[model samples]
Target chain A: MEPLTVPGMLPALEEIGRYVMAAAAEAGLDKRASYRLRLAVDEIATNIVVYGYQPSGTEGDIIVSSTIDDHVLKIALEDTGPEFDPRQHAMPDEDELTRPLEDRQMGGLGVYLAFEGVDDFHYERVDGRNRNIFVVNRPSAAPAT
Target chain B: MDVNIRSIDDITVVAIEGALDAATAPIAQQQLLPLATAGCRILLDLTGVPYMSSAGLRMLLSTYRQLSGKDGRIVLVGVAEEIQDTMSVTGFINFFTLRATPEEGIAALKG
Candidate 1:
């Protein structure tokens, strides 16, 4: 699918989701896989906009591009914001996840869910750009369109 | 996201009719949090929501926290399968009462 470049802001999240969903549909992903892919991308993109760009007091654009191979669909989100690696962030442990509602902390839940929702998540810094990649395997029985 | 709020015999039924993600979560929070006052009973109808990211989960947790000690209660109805999986992954699913329909949700909240 063609890369989608949108401003790194909150309002652009919906557009990002739309781009991911379209890519998923093209890949013939099932509803569950499609939703998970969208959720994973949305979570990381949200983090990029809210924590990466908003905190730095700078504005940039998020470039979302997708590629579908025979066995997998990979989506990459590239942004020029500060060097923020989602893998470096600590995910909530079992104890933290099982905490009572009143005591539950909201900090890392999104990042954790984003990584957990996808089949594979990778983070890298290439030439000063943060590239977070999410992959979901296409079902073997899914017929090619 | 469109949040519709109504009362069914002291149970505030809020039906959300759109994707609940980062962009729309704040809007949902603005409309749903205020209804978490003391002794409030809420029935959240999520039938119209086809997708929900972690931002939606955070908003739901925030609402649950607000109603924790205030004797308020909340029940979720018509949660989609995908959203339920996400909620289960985050452990947020254990905090709320889940019902299959609005009638069941209202009954659960009332009981």
Candidate 2:
């Protein structure tokens, strides 16, 4: 599996998103599933860049690696930023999600969708580095257009 | 991302193409928020938008908030199915009116 390492910043998200989607497609993920994989990776990468590195003005980089096992694709993102477990943030409750636009709050919504789009999500603090792992199960056939 | 703002009768249409991810969402927000706040009846044409990330959701939510207080409405047109799934899962799909085409969206907004 080829690994991609890039500076941790919002601008890097465009390239990162493209890489993850290509990896997903290589794993035979359908269009919808590939989109979800891209979404999941983008959310986590954005969080690491925006909340993890940018705030402290620390120069850091995110390393992304992907592997396919059977029909499942596993993508892992490793960053040297401060260890903040995105899973620790509680997902937005249904009430919060369903609230009227005037009353809806933005907290946790991005992280919530990140988790929602993937089949499984795991976070680990390895050797003082933050590692986020995501898995997507690809369907045998693409959805009908 | 390409953002084209036009007017069809009483509806203000903003046509966007490309992925509405983190990098592009801010650009869209910058362009759409001002119009939404100005109480323009807006129809977001997303036929060219193949995907949208959470940042896009935030922009839509903010636009909704801004338009709600005013006598303004926000309608979505040509939203891709995958985008619709994300919106449905996040529970934000119910807040906006969705149509298959920009003409339908404009019609709904005008009606």
Candidate 3:
């Protein structure tokens, strides 16, 4: 069990994304799955940077945990800044793409895309922390194209 | 991020060279918004853009929506194949215009 604690800022997002990607690949996750994992991790990290904590101080942080068994990559993100439930938000409308720009809305598209990209996603606020856990991977024995 | 600005057929052309992911995305949004409001035909040459993320999508889509509201134009030029695949996966292929190059994007914006 390895863990990383970030102060919950936008710049740190890519750092954590890279870390997750490297760990996922080392654990034998597929290439496509790894990119999807990056996207999911970015979404969650951005959420923490934006809504997880107040701007005045640095008491809040995001903690990421990883566990690899065989080829499975299970990742968890827990933040103690604020109580946020991304799962409760509705998915963005993909059809909004072709709509004239005037018809499109400005926010929430990433969360929906993140939700659609991952396999198993869960969100929970447990004992004063917002915990998000998701799994991404493919079998190590899967043939490489 | 590398930006190359040029002019062709009376349109201001900007070529972005890099991955428009979580890190470099705000730059894309910030730079493109000014071009959008300038109200001339604008072409974003993404031929050099190898990849784009949700942050980048939000910028593009949000700018597209804002420009369309003002009856302005934004054209897509040189979107890479890999980006097209990501766009399709996220259903953005159906949302924004996909162009082969800057000239074609300018033509499409005019139409």
Which wins on DockQ, candidate 1 or candidate 2?
1
Model 3 misplaced stretches (Cα beyond 4 Å): A54-59, A93-100, A140-145, B21-23, B37-39, B48-51, B69-72, B80-82, B89-91, B101-111
Q: Score the docking of each candidate (DockQ).
A: 0.82, 0.75, 0.42
Ranking of predictions according to DockQ: 1, 2, 3
Q: How high is the CA lDDT of each candidate model?
A: 0.90, 0.86, 0.73
Top-DockQ structure, candidate number: 1
Worst 10 residues of 1 chain B by lDDT: B87-96
Best by lDDT: 1
Candidate 2 has a DockQ of 0.75
Question: Which model scores highest in TM-score?
Answer: 1
Against the hidden reference, what TM-scores do the models get? 0.96, 0.93, 0.80
Q: Write the per-residue lDDT of candidate 1 for residues A1-145, one digit (tens) a residue.
A: 8899999998898899999999999889988889888988999999999989999999999999998888888999999999999988878899888888778777788788788778999999999899999999888876665
Quote the lDDT for A22 in model 3: 78
lDDT of 3 by residue, A1-145 (tens): 4698887777677667767877777667766677777778778777777766645354677888887765457788898876778887666565765454456663676676677657778888899888888776567684432
Which candidate, 2 or 3, would have the higher DockQ against the true structure?
A: 2
Question: In order, how many clashes per candidate?
Answer: 0, 0, 4
